[model samples]
Target chain A: MIKVNQLKKSFNDLEVLKDINFEVKRGEVLSIIGPSGSGKSTLLRCLNFLETPNAGTITIDGLTVDVENVKKQDIQQLRKKSAMVFQNYNLFKNKTALQNVTELLIVTKKMPKAEAEKIGMEYLAQVGLADKANKYPVTLSGGQQQRVSIARALALNPSVILFDEPTSSLDPELVSEVLQVIKQISTKDTTMIIVTHEMDFAREVSDNVIFMADGYIVEEGHPSQLFGNPQQARTKSFIQQLNEKH
Target chain B: MNFDIGYMFSLIPEIMEYIPITLFMAILAMILTIIIGLLLTFMRSSKLKVLNYIATVYISFFRAIPMLVQLFLIYYGLPQLFPVFTKMDAVTAAVIGFGFKQAAFASEIFRAAFLSVDKGQMEACLAGGMTKVQAYQRVIIPQAFRNALPATGNTFISLIKETSLAFTLGVVELFAEAKMQASNTLRFFEAYLAVALVYWAIVVIYSFLQSKLERLLEKPYRT
Candidate 1:
């Protein structure tokens, strides 16, 4: 389980996340949807300590960290509990796909090379890229690179996976391939927090959905309830704007 | 005096005897430059203000002054500043001068290379449960080096040419040998031309090796 309370963040004088709060039960998929500059991505990054919040407590699987006074060990432990999939598919450019997946296991987990390779290849197979293991990321398409990143994240077996707009950077024709991979992962008992703009995918796969606007959670409930019948005026107009654009 | 092609050819083999000295100085200086440059990079990148300031001043001073001036200072000026330096030989001073200048340039190259790597790579490594140090060792530095190869190749080629200055300190390198041969034979034109050819040939060969190294480094990055 993951829980965040009174999370507040600001850049110098401008507040980005204002007293935001949310929680996700184990094995649940929670999707955070909002317009641009609504602090959705910042919230996802804060959970992983990529952007430290000015105030809050993040608890994951019984380990908690106060945002203001975090220690090195706490950060490492918190990071070990979660893995992130970035929008740009930040694979190690110098490494082949197989090596990218195997590096963390060998470096962080201290697993034997043969064992790590086996698991890495298995995850590559799972992502339908087993044949491309020898290829470097520069040679792969955006969709394929994102899949490799996903495989890399999956191989670590973290308690939760935080995806910050994983498809936001892909070309239109390539979006489905990556979304399909995430959809497959959502079927398993993996806990996930996805901040994305893909409303249909979110409505289809998410167990709970939160609508954020200007750093505040305007509405929260089951995906169908929130997407089908948004209660607040802000949530209604936001969903309306998205539907109009579609 | 007319240029004598045949005499210059004859002088090639004799002058070539000192090729080892030039190469030895260049190789030693190259090694020292790499070590000092990396250390400077670390100091510049460190959070300590004092270390960063010192590294900055060091890079600036070495880069600002001419290589010849630096060589003279190390060989002639050093003994004046510190009496112990009176015992230091010209060859040692030449190595120190060339190596120090190369390090300044190399530090900038490496620092720029490290900056060229996307910031996302570091975040991705951290998210994978790797420490900051491990991320740098395993991911960031490797990619940064890839970005730095072409510039580093240029630096290395320049270093090879710059070693010619050592002859001014009376180290008897390729140029020094040619100078001596010309003084004896009074064939200044032939001797200087032969020395120039040797240096040109060495640069060409080293450039070829550099391209091959670059190709190997770029293999993984090729689309």
Candidate 2:
């Protein structure tokens, strides 16, 4: 469903993603665990063209996006196919939760207002915030706001959903509500590429886990294999460090 | 002639006549300033280099020139250059001069408001699948207007006081009317005192409106 080869990116002289190659099958969950500033978030952003890659090609369903040639219609279609949930939530503070979801559907997709609102309410209910649909983002807890953000992405029916440290901003108590939502979402056929620090959640949920450091994917295999008995000294060292962390 | 308190108070009918004309100029100049000021703001923020440069130069030139000089330029300079403008009166010239002059200042207020808007709001709007125009209208511009409302109200209070300068151009507004009354009746002190009272009353009312507007616009964002 997704493919990348020699995917290189850099900010000026500082390379962020160096010679990364990876692929994921349809309906698979791929978790990218990495150190701070390892370009995991940048890779997620590149998938949707929010931040254009500095080099290399990303192909999804035969649509190629890269530095040389990216078609206009393909980018728009790719954006629809890939939805992103940010750490900050990025909800429009001026809009209610209902307005947030229905906004793009009505404005960009040209869905009828009434139809969009109905579907929006359904999604809000799915995320367990049906009563809070009319409330502004300011009125919501960090966890509730993150759920609203998930509903917003779900309403679009994207093929691939990207999560960038989704629960990083929430309280420890609130993180479960958001993680539960993601766990429930995983039961479906939707593909997911999650970048997160929640090790237990990552180990329990991800079908494949890739450990990254210094802009390179140092290890990639089934999570059970990588988490159980790893081969590399660097991978075992980072996992040992992470065991002491939690 | 010991301050003739009773007689000075009796000039009510005379001062009332000038109030409407004064308000008319303030309202007209305010309307003109906001419309053209918004245009200048768009030019200043736009990508076109020449247009942005022109907007910058226009703002600097008007802001640098004194209002009195701007009034004189419109009243005296325009008549000499265009014979067709000879029929235009002092009131028209005052509106033209003050309106353009205030626009330079108002554009800065708008620019600041536009800048304070969160960059993420636009990106999120686009990610939700909104087109560029839809994102700007739905997500960016409304929030910018809310941010701009309080600062723009301050400009309105200053504009009302600036109307006093219109009298210098011989527009016969409140200040000019008071001056004419003082000179004719030899009640210079009483006449100027009435003018002061009138200006104070207008400002007090406008200040109340400014606070009311700020409160109403801020209701949604106040949390």
Candidate 3:
């Protein structure tokens, strides 16, 4: 389970996440949807300590971190509990796809090379890229790279996986291939928090959906409730704008 | 003023004898410059006020002064303050001078190379559960080194040529050997031209190796 209370973050003088609060039970998929620059990504990043929050406590699978005085060990433990998939893929440009997946295993976990390679190959096969294991990231398509990234995150076996606009940087035709890989894993036991702009995918895969606007959570409920009947004016207008575009 | 082709050819064998001295000093200086350059880069990026200030001032000071002046200070001036420096050989003094001066330039190249790598690469490593130090060691440094190769090669080539100034401190290197041979026989043009050919050959060989290494490192990034 993951819980955040009164989370606050600021860049210089400008506040980006303001008194945010939420919870996700184990094995639940929560999707956060909002217009651009609404702090959705920042909120997700704060959970992983990527952007250190100014105040609040975050509990991931029973390890609570108080942001005000978090230690380096606490941050490392937090990262160990969760892995993030970035929009740009960000695979180690120097490593082949299999090496990218196995790097942390061998370096941080001290697993033997053969054991790590076995697990890496399994994850690569899971993402349907087993044949591309030895290929460097530069040789793969953007979609393939993102799939390898997803495979890398899956291999960590973290308590929660954070997807920050994973498809935001892919070509239109390649989006489905990457999304299919995410959907394949969403059915498993791992908890997930996804901040994305793909409304249809969110509505389909998420158990709970959150609508954020200007750094505030305007509404939260089951996807049916949030999408079918938004209560806040900001959420309603934002949904209406998205609908108009479609 | 006659160009003696035979004398120039004959001078090659004698001048080549000092090639090892030239190469030893330049190679030693290059290694020192890399070590100091990397230290300066880390200090500047350390985010501590005192470290950053020291690194900034050090880089600026070393870059502003000429290599010849710096060599004189180390070889001639240092002995005045510390008697121990009087025992130091001219080769050691020359390497120290060249190392300190060239590091300033090499640090900037390293800085730019580190910056050229994507910010997301470090974040990905961290998210994957590696420590900041591990991230830099395993991912960031390898890519940065590759990016730094071309510029670093240029610095090393220039350093080789700059070792000729060590003759001012009385080290018998390639250029120094050439000067002695020219003075003994009064064949200044032939002897100097022969030495220049040797320097040109060394630069060409190093440049070739550098490009080959660059291509090898580029394998992972090629589409």
Native contact fraction per model = 0.81, 0.46, 0.86
**Residue A118's lDDT in candidate 1:** 99
Give Cα-based local distance difference scores for all models: 0.92, 0.84, 0.95
The i-RMS of candidate 3 is 0.9
lDDT (0-100) at residue A126 of candidate 3? 98
Q: Sorted by lDDT, highest first, which candidate order results?
A: 3, 1, 2
lDDT of 3 by residue, A12-100 (tens): 99988888999999999999999999999999999988888999999999999999989999999899999999999999999999999
Could you give the candidate ranking by DockQ, starting with the highest?
Answer: 3, 1, 2
After TM-score superposition, the amount by which residue A149's alpha carbon in candidate 1 deviates from its true location, in angstroms, is 0.7
Please identify model 2 stretches exceeding 4 Å from their true place: A4-6, A60-63, A71-74, A231-233, B1-28, B31-60, B78-93
Error (Å) of candidate 3 at residue A164 is 0.3
lDDT of 1 by residue, A52-80 (tens): 88999999999999988899889999999
The pairs that clash in candidate 3 are: none
By TM-score, rank the candidates, best first.
3, 1, 2
Identify the leading candidate in terms of TM-score: 3
